[model samples]
Target: MAGTKTIDADVAIVGCGVAGLYCALNLPHALRVVLLAKTTVDECDSMLAQGGICVLHDPDDYESFFEDTLRAGHYENRLESVDMMIRASRPIIDDLIKRGVRFARTATGELDYTREGAHSRPRIVYHEDITGEEITTHLLACVRELPNATVFENTCMTDILEGFDADGRRVCRGIVAEDAGGAHLQVNADATVLATGGVGGLYKHSTNYPCLTGDGCRVAAEHGVLLEHMDFVQIHPTTLWTQKPGRSFLISESARGEGAILLNDAHERFCDELQPRDVVSGNILREMRREGAEHVWLSFERVPREELEHHFTHICEQCREEGYDIFSEPIPVVPAQHYFMGGIHVNSDSETTLPHLFAAGETCCNGVHGRNRLASNSLLEGLVFAQRAADKIMRDRFAADTAAQLAVAASERSRFVAGSRDVTDVALLCGAE
Candidate 1:
């Protein structure tokens, strides 16, 4: 305990993916910010995102976009959150462009928009196929350059320390984390944000990084925080089927958006490919069951060869490495757990039930996605809400400062040894360690 390191900040952001980085960038430069990356910055699930973020095509398109998201979510989505995300799309995109994140453009210099399933129009703005990497790498670079921001890699947040204010209201004080060397680090902050990714690691097959085992949700649950729709997990309709075990390669839904089609063993087109993900996943599973096959075939022969090479180079190379050619043949594909639509429930401001604690991205269920998520909307929801969270944090800085005043209420806060606390300690209380 004597060797434990302690750091303090105006804000502590857990996770270094798109949501976390974006939130940090939006915070005021005067605030001392500390960002924790469970592993290396490159290992976040956001880097593995293949599809582009969604944008508003027109004022008239808002209703359609809203409907697409609600329909996919089975109408259970929070209307206000949906409206907020849709309205905030363009501004977020503008910020990204201003920050030097590039999206594909046409010869006329207009942004290149692609269509994913369930969308009525072309609203997805991408950079070839590696949109996520382009966006996150730029954000990470920007984060590194910020004088007030500090990033810690290989740090695992083991618990959210809780203490009561003078009024006896339970509030968050800080977090306990372990570095790569297993040394304990106590991070105290005025505001704590949880942008940790989803529960993909819990599945046998997922498109998410293995380290993302719903750590945020598990931690929130231990603290008695309200979580919504934990059972609502989204299974992507197309991940490349392979005999080897590990992270499954996602065959981006954009491929189907570009004119590829799914086929049964008889090579017959079954359901419409542009339906919501649940419908498509159900159809695929039904087809597999009826045909007694492990996977269905997705053919891209009709898609333009030049476009395939230009837009999906990474996918093409990966398939080629596996002895398949996207330009000439169909690839074996199946559904796998892709996203969690439920997590620590938050308000429009992204503040959780716990005082001074907020969550964003896939780690928080603001009810934007409702029952399921529309394709390409995940990134938009994250950026929009994360920005909102930062705005709220800055607006109520006085409240956070008051909460920060209570940091030393519990003298044993940093005295608990790393991974040595029992049921009586905050670590066990938060279901970590």
Candidate 2:
């Protein structure tokens, strides 16, 4: 093992995806931040998200938007979280624009909107098919230019360090992280945030980076943090079926939104293409079972050829590489583990049950996505909650006097060094939360 190193910051953010990057960007510039990535910053699942992010197009669309989200979640969602995410949509979009992230726009200069599964209206903002990449890349660029922010790639947070506060409440001091070179790092901070993506690594097949194994949720659980909705996992209805043994390529729901159709062995439409993820996945599974088919076929023939080339170029090229011309024929697809709707239970401000610890993105169940996530809402939910976490931390935690901050950090560091522990056992691992 390499020698261990220690560092201090006002905040320590785990994961460098959209949620982590957005949280770091929204933090007060006066406070220093240390952002950690498990691998290269661009290797996150957020960059692989092809579908767009949902937006509340107008005030009048609020009710329908809420209903759509709840319907997709099977009415198990927390209303307040849903409300907060929807209301915060416009401001988040505006902030992204200010940070130089551009979404698709029409010839007349209006924001281009698209529809996806389970949504009642076309309120998604995208940049072709790589919306997540577009937004996350912009956030990464913005974070790189911040004087108060420092990003460390190839740093995996192995465990969250917990210490007792003055009031005897157990709180998170920071984390023990390991880098690719085998150097162990002790990061102590006034606040700690986990934006560590999802549980893709635990699945046989997924539409996520294979490295994401719900590390944040697992660490939180080991520390006795309260988790929620441990059983609710969302399997995407359409992933390009390659019999290969690795991460599956996702055929974004936006294809169906733009007129793709699902067919079984008999080439018959077996289910509503626009249903929520769980519903669609269940329907496909049933069809596969009933027809004795290994995979279902997804046809994009009905979509306009020009739109296919322009909006779904990545998917088209990938399919062609697999020896299937998506424009001419249907491609094989199957349900695969996509997103987790359950995780470390967090409050409205993205605070976990543990004091001084917060979680956002797929790592935490803030309840915006209850039983299932609506199509294209994952990216928006992630950024919205991440910004909220930063907002709360900066305003209430790190905005204190410098003396107080220093004292807190000193105390936490002393306690952490005395304990000196690393997470080696992952017995707390679960199927979902």
Candidate 3:
């Protein structure tokens, strides 16, 4: 028991963020699933996302949303991936609502949609400013209620488990993991998913959880999984600037979407606040350079006091704690490493080149973001593709692959015990929600 333990599951998913949770939720109840987390689920970069999740609120708006996404990515986006995400947007939003997720509603009781940078119109649904929290928390709860799933916080993948099928091809078996007590584990499964999030922790300053060190891509590269756009890191244009260390606090892009503006040290508005993220971040850097200032300003003067209080409760509290009253004055802001648009390459169905292996969320680049990611699209892209990955698993994992499947079982039969951890219940969130 002290050495490497063996875990047998129908599917093993790494990373317990939205992608991981949603993937678990979508899988069939008959399948035993194991979800591994680097830390408690709340620390995921998905929880730090403050802006919102994009959707196709209007049928005619499809063209607008598509064009906006393309323009933001500088037309480097794969047309098929972008089209699939946009087409799948509303259904994903609807699915979240049915899963006990709470979204902000207007006076008429209709779901409220807001605008963000690079968005042509207000089509992003949110829950105040903690949209990611609301969405992922409920999804985590849904995942927790599944009797077939076990979530292991403090467990993380050190590397993927690999074995050859009857065809003599290298296939992903599952992941080699470490538990909270530092015991190695071989989690063998019929299908394996890498939902291990982003590369933000690699930078000295980022808005992501410190654990997101791009482990998924690193291991995927080790297995020679096709990767794309490894250099396409995204930096958000606005984060509350402080000399203090720790994760950078993001000032939601919706702040600008709701009419907040970025200002120079001289109190002059320098760039259009609602431009694509990369464009605005570049602008802020140039302005800071010209003025020899450490940081620029973000003025919420145009935003109503009531709106600030209601829409950005967390932001207001954090700024006040930092000695800035955002309701009356501007907050010092700077660009910081935020999202990774590049990742392990996948297709429209979230399938990587490797057999029985898949990737979703920030760890996998499906070319929807191209060279740059538009605001609030990360959550949508993650959910849409993750669900598709699950669907692909459900549809194809057990179909016409018996020779390879039997080969995988035979290869690992000495160590793997089917459903070895299936009846063992693992806690989720640990009351952090």
Q: All candidates' TM-scores?
A: 0.92, 0.91, 0.92
Measured over all alpha carbons after superposition, the RMSD of each candidate to the real structure, in angstroms, is 11.0, 11.3, 10.5
Question: lDDT tens string, model 3, 169-193?
Answer: 8888888988788889888998899
Better of 1 and 3 by lDDT: 1
- How does each model score on lDDT? 0.92, 0.91, 0.90
Q: Which residue pairs in candidate 1 have backbone atoms (N, alpha carbon, C) closer than 3 angstroms, thus clashing?
A: none
The Cα error of candidate 1 at residue 65, in Å, is 0.6
Instruction: Give the total clashing residue pairs for model 2.
Output: 0
Best by lDDT: 1
* Candidate with the larger lDDT of 1 and 2: 1
Error of 1 at 356 (Å): 0.4
lDDT per residue (tens digit) for residues 59-89 in model 1: 9999999999999999999999999999999
Predicted candidate 1: what Cα RMSD to the true structure? 11.0
Candidate 1, run of 10 with poorest lDDT: 409-418
Candidate 1 ranges beyond 4 A from true positions: 398-433
